[model samples]
Target: MVKLIGDLIKDVIEPGFCLGCNACVAACPMQCIKKEENEIPVLKTGCINCGICYGQCPQVVDPKTLQKAIFGDNPTDELLGTYTQALAVEAKDAIMKAHGQDGGAVTALLSSLLDDGYIDGAVVVGTGEAPWQPVARVATTTGELIECAGSKYTRTPLFIGLRDAVNLYYRKRVAIVGTPCNIVASWRMQFSEPTNRHLGETIRLRVGLFCGGVFRYKEFLKDIIERQLRAPLAEVAKFDMKDGRFVIYLRHKPKRELALSAVKRYIDLPCKICSDFTAEFADISVGSAGSPHGRSTVLIRTPTGAEAFDVAKKFRKFSAVELEKVKPGIEGVRLEAKAKKGAAAKELEIMRRQKKPLPVWLQERPPEPPKETIESLKSISRV
Candidate 1:
């Protein structure tokens, strides 16, 4: 029997392995799946059992299979994943730089793409009705992209914006910025059978953010920030993870910080099992780990990504420091990735010993492809 959302819930969601990337909700033809704040998706009335939701779910899909399909037989890096080059970059736009989490490279890159007419819209996270809460939306202009700047340490279903971009707005070419899990779900939607490939095809670029983990909104914002720290959410200027602490910048008060260990309990459960810290499947990955306080570390992972970066650079959207010029350089990024992967591996091992359910990708290895097939797959361009 073909698996359905119920099967997906039993295998992934119940196991606390669901990434909550919203691929299933976006790809559902009947629009039966709905995602609520800090919850796994719930199915409504439709019961076609088309299996599209199951196929597009990042946890249900085998990541290795998707990697082989996307990156082909390229020699894999133990830490940082497949990439062409690394750089330290900072956005030139003063407003964007000021409002952004670090260097504002992501905001600048998306603006550059929009200015160049490369993409009709971009799926990005913006502040929602509640303070510090993230809501996904489609940005069609540079101003809109800038408004959506900064990092939300909480997870949002980005694919919902993707669906609105393609289906509601009828945007032909689009870009998406998301975490590693979100990138994985994008690949699953692109290559998985019984999925809406058109939704994947509309995505011209995938800009991934380096993620340590995400926090539950209620616990992190309400319990930790409001009650514990005695800071009102509305007064918060920004949220950041710096030097092993969760830092909160408030508009009218001195910034407050708590050691990450203090808030570890609030981290989403699924993040513990995730190993991709640099978004290995993304076109490009950007983060603050390897660069100076005001700069971002960027990894150009694909030819398409390289092309987009080049366009942005040519337009003077951001200033770049060559990997060698940056102190610690890619090594810094590699160390962070290694630490995250190590922690995940240990968690997986612990879960295994406890006889808990695990995602198929973590439990089973897919057979290697033939040499000829690998070569052919590599020749197929994602662009």
Candidate 2:
């Protein structure tokens, strides 16, 4: 059966595979989609079945097929995806590093991109009305970038920022930094023929953050933060999941933490279904997952990503160390990635027995692409 945008609501959304990334909402030309307080997208009224929303959705197409479309037939590592280089990096700017969740490489890279005119602005998630509440914003200057530097453990519908950055703000070239699911959405939107060409043009760069999982803010904040941690939301100076604990740094109190496994019960269903640990589809992926306290593991996955790194290096934004020389080396990342994939595969099987459709990412890997599709991919290659 041919799939349409409406099909996404039943096949993926209702089944709990939707990442709430807002890619579908941005793709809808009718402006019929809206996300409520619960963080799920709902179609308002007009039902054209135009398919752009589904085409732009990451959950609809197989990740393996998308990878082939982007990376050609050259085999990629099972864990790291296709990459030109891997390194441990840290921002040279001390202030950025201080504000950063880890190494500040993402903010430093965006700073260089803006200064070099590679991008007009960047889409970032920052503290919102409530502490740790993620608000998507366009960072047009270094100060704005710095304000959006750190991580928010909660899932933010980050791709919605693209709509504002392009339609409302009228930015010509934009960079976006987001988690693994967001990267999947961006890469699909960038290449999907049904997506608005102008909207696709504004996306100049994709920076992905490695993610373990995202906690539901209402649950994690009210229950865990206020009730268990005995701290108010406004007092949180910094919050992150490190090692095996959920660490919270308050402005006036001693550091507090809880077992990471204890908090897993608060993770949303979509995150539980997600398998991309290192953002396998992103041009460049950065995370503290397998790095020392002061460094970030940077995976340069495409030629464009490598070029961006070279430019950032020329500007002396950050320094890179050999991946093998780092504390939690490439092997650490590989093991985690494999474990996540295995867990997802097992969950997919259980869902299958329950008469639910498996998400695109969990489908069997695709074989070689047809000659025509390979040619099509080459023509569409932006990097």
RMSD of 2: 2.5
**lDDT of each prediction vs. the true structure?**
0.83, 0.80
Clashing residue pairs, backbone N/CA/C < 3 A, model 1: none
Task: Give the worst 10-residue stretch by lDDT in candidate 1.
Answer: 374-383
Q: TM-score each candidate.
A: 0.94, 0.92
Q: Give each model's clash number.
A: 0, 0
Q: After superposition, how far is residue 201 of candidate 2 from its true place, in Å?
A: 2.5
Residue 329 of candidate 2: its Cα lDDT? 88
Model 1 residue 164 distance off true place after TM-score fit, in angstroms: 0.4
